[model samples]
Target: MRVLKRLVFWMFGFATLILVTPVEALEKHPLNYVDPFIGTDGTGHVFPGAVVPFGMVAPGPDMEDRGWSYSSGYQYQGRSILGFSNTHISGAGIGELGDVLLQPSSGTKWTRKTVNFRSSFDKVTEKASPGYYAVTLKDHGVRVELTAGQRVAIQRYRFDRSGKVQVLLDLQHGILFGDGPRVLKSEVKTDAVRGEISGTVWSKNWVEREASFIVRFSRPISNVITLPARPGDRAPRLILEFDLRQSRALEARIALSTVDVAGARANLAAFGQPRFDVVVQSARSQWSTLLQRIEIEGSDREKRIFYSALYRTLIHPSDIADVDGRVRGPTGQVIKAETGHYYSTLSLWDTFRGVHPLFTLIVPERVDGMIQTMLEHHRAQGYLPLWTAWGRETWTMIGNPALPVIADAVAKGFQGFDKAEALAAMIATSTDPRPNAPAWAQRDWRAYEEFGYLPYDLNEGEAVSKTLEYGIGDDAVARVARHLGKHEIGKRFEVRAAGYRHLFDPSTQTMRARNKAGGWRTPFDPLVPTSPMNNPGDYTEANAWQYTATPALHDVDGFRALVGGSSGLSRWLDRFFSLPSLGDNKHLGQEALIGQYAHGNEPSHHIAWLYAYSDTPERGYEMIERIARTFYSDRPDGIIGNDDCGQMSAWYVFANLGFYPVEAASGRFTLGRPLVSKAKLHLANGTVLLVERLDMKDVELNGRVISEPTIDYKSIMVGGRLSFPHFTAQVPKAN
Candidate 1:
């Protein structure tokens, strides 16, 4: 009996050991239950805002453009929100406005001055899913819920706080930086605007939006808000609110339809018909799936904020319909409901920098929807959208960056849109260096697509810098076209690919802009960033020097030339980032620091990856590893810039995986330092791809020389294919 008992005990011990219970029993998966308040407390960079997957705009808070460029969403600064607009810029950098604004106000006349609606009494709870957001405005004693379909917005506002409340609507609101308007219409209730909306930014692309309501408050407001008789004499924005009491229960359902307003309302009435609790539950479940995709072991606070930020990304494209998926389009014309789904409101310039890219990783299927929307907008409006707010494409930035976005998607193997149509769009957009062009104009980058260099006369950008940096996207498009069997087109692109040297000036030893006569600009300052035709040098949001090392075309080879030779280039790059700043005004807004590296923006997101493209793979690993451990933390200070949708996070996810997409739309990735050692991608294909960062210790966070490096990382894919620098694996001879 004693021997048998000993044997049983030994068996039990063995089982327990093999179970491998780490420090924690995985008590909560990263996505199990997440608090939605972490990112809402600061720059409000991450809005607890709501929308559909890959939506164009989101209806949430606006800080009146007080913070950074993308602060158009909910801001952490204010107490009473102005109102929710049908159009909003997503993941932007310099910030602007869209069309269709509506706000809940107390007194009669709609005021442009911000109203103070602070409440010591209640709190707001916002739960966001793939296509919706719900919030209970506590002080107002109201429960408000919202959702987006494809192009419409539906709002359900419940009144209870005061018992006798009014729901106000204002249409005279939109945020524009310089000479433009954020608002197109300002009125109370209407028959068709049905609370209709329409307009465009300086960009020439047109937009349209509408809002409708189905109030089922516990009680109705005895007093109605005083609004204007005609919208002509007023600012084109919307302002109105519903009043209620605190003790009573109020519930509302909002839906969005990319088809039309009625369709939007219908979609809301249908899909959103589930009990409020049910909708909330569904949203939570969806969030669970997205968050669970990547489980991180971290503190409770970090998890809350991380989950909250992820939720914020889904705020746009809110439910806009009842059940049939019908929503209003930008023309204010009610259209048939989307067969699948339609989404709107994309601040492409800003999001293209990060947010959209991040979505490509988490929700790739939605990418096709988002990309098609941009193309459709191009067909309807003439030019590709810049700061697409709600349905209006508010012209903000310079480049029609959808090129890069489409290229990236194609490279990642995403589908849903017609590839031929997409290719047609890309090839058309290849040239015509005019300040702006019709949507279908730039079919192909004119001469030498690969080597197309930006002339210094463009006045903006690191003109010459954009020439080099932009080649990557051109090459990316060419790669996809070639893969699709357009070899003739590919051959042409291959030759143009090396044309990045057209702007190179050996005298200045940097990429300089060439004039029509092939002469380099005499006065140049790479550090002084400027924009097109503007009285500046450099590029938009950054300096010329900052964009110089942008090895978008092909890093390994590009670096070789910039430094004169591979060996010399490797040493120079190592020491270059370690040097001090030439100190220019380039440090504006999110352009915070400069050690010859813009930790504040996007162009440098891949700067550290340059080392991996070099012969000293060890140096690349060390730099990336150190940066991951330093710049990215699980704290409020965790992000270096406005999460710019998901660009910042994508950079984190990529570097952590030990590789980052060198060009936004390229199939290539340059190895970099990684945060985690190993990760697996759950691709659409049945195949599961694994990435191992090997060992990356001895990282130099403070830019100090790396005294030690544990890993030798060359720019290679997880599949073991050499990316650039032309390293070939020779077959070993049999012994």
Candidate 2:
């Protein structure tokens, strides 16, 4: 009865509830289960701000310090908010773009100190939904509500008493480059008749770009106060003081554009000036419609965590192009999207693992757009993008991540992308020696051609990481070629995909860096963890034990053989998970450790599935189940590590869904013990894939028992029922 009463209360206040008894209750909409604050407290770095799915504008609060904890611009532990900004990065290790801040204040003297004008708020008064956030400012006795459209952020401020209220637009406020972004151009002008403040800000921190925005208010302003500044200089702020004597509520609609101020105006015009409640309703509708693609049956807590993770997966690889398809290219040229909407902020090194695969499942239309964008980038530059921001290839992380994504799309029979052009791009990236590009951007094809792998002594790079990633890329290329019936290209790259073997050291039974003389680097400590980037002789953000388990996606049989067959591999995995750490000096920031397996990082992402190739498949199930339960939650500090632009959240989404993609482009997903009782995947092809867990060792597809536990992309896309009769953690012999 107590549970029933709480459910009733939750239905009215928290959820979109339907009246029914507990035994006959209907599953809640996925949007109703999302908790935006899950990753805001810990090192998860996810901002609990308002954003539409794949929307460019992530409007949220910014803290005083742009330190590691506040990388996303908002931390749950923060006591006060400096201001609300229009742009925010979600779950990234680096910080950028808290651009165009607006603070609502009452009785504020003109002061440059942010602390003086800041407002403190209690967590109890704060509320966040899919596309809305609200909090009561204790200092100003005002209630601020935030909601966003595709390109606009609407803020509604409700004051307790009617008086003169000021809205401060601070152009100098940003969360990048230590304190603030370097302003290259700033212009803030007011149209008194229209009650609008228009501005253009060109700034450079992580990436140099331009943003033009317009702020329109509900009431006319009595005074326009531009803060004092030196001669021939742009002031950082513009204060609009309005006499609220006639009304107690004030609203501001802000729109951003990467092109020009006119573009911003056009965006605002297209969004329509709906009332705050209507806008909030529209935002909620959008989220509810998008999140309804997947249906899962679980407890309230499980549903909350699952939907929150699903929300995070759609936040990045943002749509950077405007409604007119006009965007700034890599070289700052005004490029127009010829085919579809061009997107930016591709964290390929992290996202290629799980996030993109999720896209291929439910949002294949967006996948087509991403491929078109990548091809456009290749046309603009010489090669595909590594990690892009604002259409500029940042070369942030290692590997040709774009290859696997494109290959995966092609393998799944996703159309509207040119396969021949994609193959040419892949070959060009692999063989072409980009002399002018940075060392990090250019994959050393000459070293690869000569040594078959990235030799530590020969290349100035993280040898093991480069070697493993290149092999994965090669395998992806081969899969795409074969899928297109280009057998020659497939066979050629199939041999190249075996290059990971060159790094395998039989004596140590782990992948190690080989010197110019083909000898293992002395002091080869497989158990001792080191930063893969800093300790560059062998790894990148991981040690030998972790890197050795990689590239198994395409060659698990060969990998098992190299580790002395299934029994030997099983023994090594046991050692890898049992030992906590080698020495007292634990690697800082390398977290979510299970033995040498670093779940916090991307390289070890596929390790949990490798045990399926061993004799002890049950061990893999137990490890995965433990990881799913221990490493995630629905609290403010729910996530265990940096979400890595939704990659961490993507892992959770897959692990809880009963399967995961082991290979990026293989078009196959390996099975694991399902965490939920049942799930229905609504695919883009207008078909539903149903999964039900039963207590048995055998599996079935559409009522026909299957020999293998894996499911192919074609099977999932075609849509049918998949059943697991039983899930148990008992060791069994390999099939």
Candidate 3:
């Protein structure tokens, strides 16, 4: 009987340990729940490739053709792989940088036709994680696996049969905006004995810059071929052939550098050849460290969406500096990085709204690095960047969005940046009408300086929208100036920050486009979108009705007064939400509508939070809850629009955390219902702020109940528990 009892006790103990071990491991990590493919389909335009957090080499497959679907190089519906490129742009509207495209082929002849060499891939067999991607090519019967180091991309090809296998390095196959081939300088050669190829391709698109690469293979090549450039083609194809067909596996390493091929070679040497599994494991470990910063408790699906969103947010603003800290500047000069890292691909217009603010909370280290990059751009190009990519500025969007990034970082107590240089850059861009500035900003510069608003009579499309955006930019500059002790400059900018109010017509109760004579434009319709093809329309991408809530960001009180009062504001919001305009809002760029609130774009991100200040906290909670639930999901088509350099994803991150950065660089977050049961924010100051959604009636911090609808940056940085109990409209009076 004693022996039998002992056996039963041991068996029960083993069973209990088995059940608890997995749960403990899962509780410690949320990275495994990340779905990299969540936004790859539909209009998400995110790349499902192998990259560490802010990696330089985003190695992925490019489709056979160019279009909106191929913006990120690879679309989920694309069936063929022309070649695997070492560098790519993520979540961008324009397709560029399929540089150093390497493809494995079995034949000797180089064919121009994509069907001759491009392999058909099975989407079902494709597997992707935060740091790894693997797909099987049906034509060559080769399995391709991709993983990356900080500066190098490693591709491993497993072939079914080996004999005269060749790797194609196609420099001519790249897309800029559409199906038209991009122009490039001719300089490419492959060395047979060394198994290496080095060259540079200078492509002109939205930004004209050069990309140099060094590709090294593990095996010796039997032959090398360089095809001649076709008609009107400046770039030609280069191929390397391996005679060892009996070998089952082959490896290739592509190191990209914006400076020079030598820089690329240095990058390859920094990450020495490691086994495929070791490289993949290193990538996974790096991503795991970054993703574990925010620990969340929620359903499996919610965790998947949350972690995936977090993953996408970190993919952009890539580190362009080589291992030796050398990078090509916007002026075609080789500039040594001052901060040990220089990042490129600044999608400032969209990211300044939410992504950079979230970076201030979790990845403060990168925030400082990004700010330094902007300052470096100013030093090299004489102006701050609005839409920078590959060390070149593109005239893609309007206003000075980089201002908010700097202001938000400074407001959040982040250090390690040159504040004086940042201020100088902001002032220079605000005053100077540089020819390279976005056309709208340049065309309306005079009106903006004299009339304090972009006038519609100038025939500048998007006059009102640019006015609102410029106002936000001015407000950011004012906040930063005040922080730097420039009281007079701060005061001047503060007055200028009210530029949006000039367009607000009291009679219409909507911000309208005003002519040079300071009168609202006639025949105005609030439901019409501005001209998308070119500027000169009243708005940029939205209608007057959709943009009506924008001024609420800086002047919530004044905005309420403009609408009449709290009651009037509430009634206006009710009509806006219940109105039927959303059903007919087929604007190409606008998406994810709840009535006129376009959740898909950045302008409407703050509208749902307005209810928090409208004397109806309950309405705010309900609207935010609905927005969170209805607009987001954990699938391939999860995103309703372009991730827009992770701005859309950042909105989800903050909204799920129970607060939102309604105003750009305002240093204030308005309250909303948090989706997670509990979340612990690990701030840069080595403090933890716990957020809990308890089933009670009061909102409390650390133990005491608080009545304020808004929280400042200092409160969160100091660290404590922000508990939101059951919300109701009958709560304590507003503070």
Candidate 4:
């Protein structure tokens, strides 16, 4: 009787807790499950969207008229968001694209090319955690929900009344970088629509047009509305409108089908579930699993920031076209998955720098898969991509961080491809003699591989950027060769690392832009980071003062010399920042105070870490903690910028991890602040890298290695649970 009573009491208490408690996964990974609309309303160009673990499709809408900008994909400047699609580009550098565009329009209600359609914020319901988004368009009175599986975008819409609900499907959507739409064929039927769309964005080669739809209306109504009242002509779109009464449940169990509408409807029948609660529930579970990968036990605030950061990182490299691995290729024919995998949208150059590294630790399985994708690029294209979007290399952002990413992945034991082939590709790419440039220009890649620097005379037009980039390449090369056991190669690259000295004007005590002839570029002003004419000489899109000092790494001896000494350098930095904004968003001055440091771009990514290289790494930690806490918030406009895919989040993760990746290739992590007091990173392997007794000051106060800890961070091993600690003791400010 006593046992029964106790059991009953326990069960009753459990039931009560369950009844009273909110959803467990609601905020498990706080930001992960965020309603992406917070900052996306009208502020930042962010999309209130959804995505799965490294999936290639981010199906959203085309509402805003901001003209295909990356972040503000569906500019809310319209009355009604047209429809949901299979793919979308997020926070892209240049512009946006609404791919596989589908809409529920009236008989002939096509969104005017210029009509503004900004819906109230209350209409959109975005489940940002795992991968789900549902919105009720106030203008249309339609309830839309979206979810993502491994490689699919599932959409369901409930219409109050099915009154000629034309489901408009447009093939020609994306930004269309350079290649125009090359849709081979499109097949649209009563219950389905399938098509193939492909064209070049940055390069000429490769075709992709794979789309599928499985739509079921409350009652089949009107007909398919396509472009022009003509046949035997290509129609850019098709609209499916239906007719039904109010209070009718219109369930759209749509599935992405690369094959055909038949396959699509079949797929829908197979997986296009109709339950809204079940769909959201499933999505929550998916996000829960992904976000929990790098679980952190911190304050609610820290968890919020951490999960949000993680959420942002998963926004891009979206699932572009086709589901079930069926795609249209260079030839105007539908082809099955060649490698048993379909992929698209790669921001590797910017992302591989920090984003890919983050994945290395969190999503180890995807690491090898991503590498394989890059390797495929090497096989298809002549070289590994610098920046690829929509199945083509964009060649934006310098530095082939692919080398570092693959090296780091392999080092961390992610082996799903042929390392030898990967190595060969890296070596082949590294040995390339010349970067694409004008005839008279000194080749960067080749000179980097051969002469250790872009020879001064060779760099006639854009000299400074050449020198700096070479310095970066040298760092990447050194790290690669050093780890790959190419000792001689590493040594050679290390020699090239000193090329920054070519710009080092000893007499001026600054690393000014120097001419190839070993002379300071005359009529020079260190503050003007750009070229001599000052219009656009390509000092890597930034002026002189910001690029001159290499503070991010432990270039103690180098920076010391440039400023004539450590104190002098500190004093220079002090004066450098004490001034007002220099009238440039790139410099981060007017918005965020700093010397020449530009939070708007990538050049300054290492600037905060410079303090780590300084005599006071703790100062770096202080600065990082302050910047992260100040700049990054928990709102729609939370992040200061595009999160640069993951660079921003990378900074936070490393800062929270109590370390920062200061270099592209170097395994060395400059110490920084710990966002969490106690954080453990569960690694694939069993061992752990314990970061205990860590305080913001611990990195500086105990500068000396206490454990014979010559951290041979030639490359990091992402093995297991990493603990980010908070120390009780605080280091005093430098006297």
Clashes of 2: 9
Clash number for candidate 4 = 50
Best candidate (score: lDDT): 2
Q: Cα deviation of 649 in candidate 4 (Å)?
A: 2.0
lDDT of 2 at 533: 41
- CA RMSD of all predictions: 10.2, 5.6, 6.8, 7.1
Give the candidates in order of lDDT, highest first: 2, 3, 4, 1
Largest TM-score belongs to which candidate?
A: 3
- Model 1 C-alpha lDDT per residue in residues 1-735, reported as the tens digit of each score: 654474456445534542565535433644433443333434325554554444434556554533353355464435555455555544444455444444442223333453443332224465553446555554555566665433334455654433434344443444444433333433233322122232221222133344333322233334433444343324432333333445334333333334444544454345534554544444444455555554443455545544545555555433233355443444444444333454554555445644565666556656786767656655554444454544544444444567677777776666777777776666555544534443422223433343266555533334554465456545655776876889887776555555666765665455667765677777776555555434445465665555566554343465576567757667656655665665544234224353667665766666666665566766666666555555555443455555565555566566545556555555445545444444555433222344443233433322233332212221121223111122212322211
| Count of clashing residue pairs in every prediction | 124, 9, 5, 50
Report the Cα lDDT for residue 486, model 4: 82
Cα error of candidate 2 at position 725, Å: 2.9
Q: lDDT of model 4 at residue 646?
A: 56
lDDT of 3 by residue, 1-735 (tens): 654474456445544543577875644466678888888887788888899888889888877447777788777777888778877777777777777788886555454443356889788989998789888888777788999988899999887787768787788777567555576575877787888878888888667888888888888878766666667678767667887657778888889889888899888888986888878877876676667668888877889889999888888888899998889887789898888798878898889877887887788768788898889888887778888778777767777888988888888777888887788888877777686555445533566878988787875578888788877778778888999999898988888888777887776667898888987889987766664463237776677877888777666877788787878888778777776663433234567777777777777888888887786667877777777777778978888778887888988898789898887587878888787888988775457899988888878778877687788878887888989875433322211
Residue 726 displacement in candidate 2 (angstroms):
2.5
> TM-score of every model?
0.73, 0.92, 0.92, 0.78
